[model samples]
Target: MEGLSELALDHVAQYFSALSEPSRLRILNYLREGERNVGELAEACECSQANVSRHLSTLAKHGMVVREGRGTAVYYRIADESIYALCDLVCGNVAKRLEAQASLLGSLAPKKKR
Candidate 1:
């Protein structure tokens, strides 16, 4: 990032933006198991087909997922497998921070008497 141009940084931001949505993250989780069509993803994500489609479109634009046509259905899968590693790294850091905050809050709480 130190030597990246504005355009490259913008693209990087767009990629992260695509992953910022919970729904899109859920969709990616499902795709991790295997390729799935829009309908399948919608059902798994508990979202409407249209909603999932919009997320998929964003994911595709970021090159995070790829689409394939199977007869009349369009299925999506992860384009860059490294995304899992990146997500795992971020999730781990977030979980650690949350745990630390919880510990701090617990210490600050008033003690209960029997």
Candidate 2:
């Protein structure tokens, strides 16, 4: 982010926005297993093909995933494997925060009777 131009920062925000949706996150997670077509993604994500396609378009626009055509099917894979590292980092931080909150709440709970 440092030394990045305003336009570049805007693009960064757009990329993050593409990742802000749960459906998109699920799609990425599924793709991590390997490339998958819309039907496979829809089935795994438990959504319609059209919905998965829309999310794919958003992810592709952000350059997060790449699509390849094969016969009547199109498959998508992660463009940058580094995304997993980023997701892992954020997930670890979130888990730590959640654990801390749970501990705080537990401390405030009423004592159990012997």
Q: Which one is best on lDDT?
A: 2
TM-score of 1: 0.96
Which residue pairs in model 1 clash with each other?
A: none
Model 2 Cα lDDT, one tens digit per residue, 1-114? 999999999999998898899999999999999999999999999999999999999999999999999998899999999999998898899999999999999999999999
Candidate 2 colliding pairs, count? 0
**Alpha-carbon lDDT of model 1:** 0.95
lDDT scores for all predictions?
0.95, 0.95
lDDT of 1 by residue, 1-71 (tens): 99999999999998899889999989988999999999999999999999999999999989999999989
* Model 1 lDDT, residue 59, Cα: 96
RMSD of every candidate to native, in Å, equals: 0.8, 0.9
Supply candidate 2's per-residue lDDT for 76: 96
Off by over 4 Å in 1: none
lDDT, residue 24, candidate 1: 90
At residue 67, what lDDT does model 1 achieve? 92
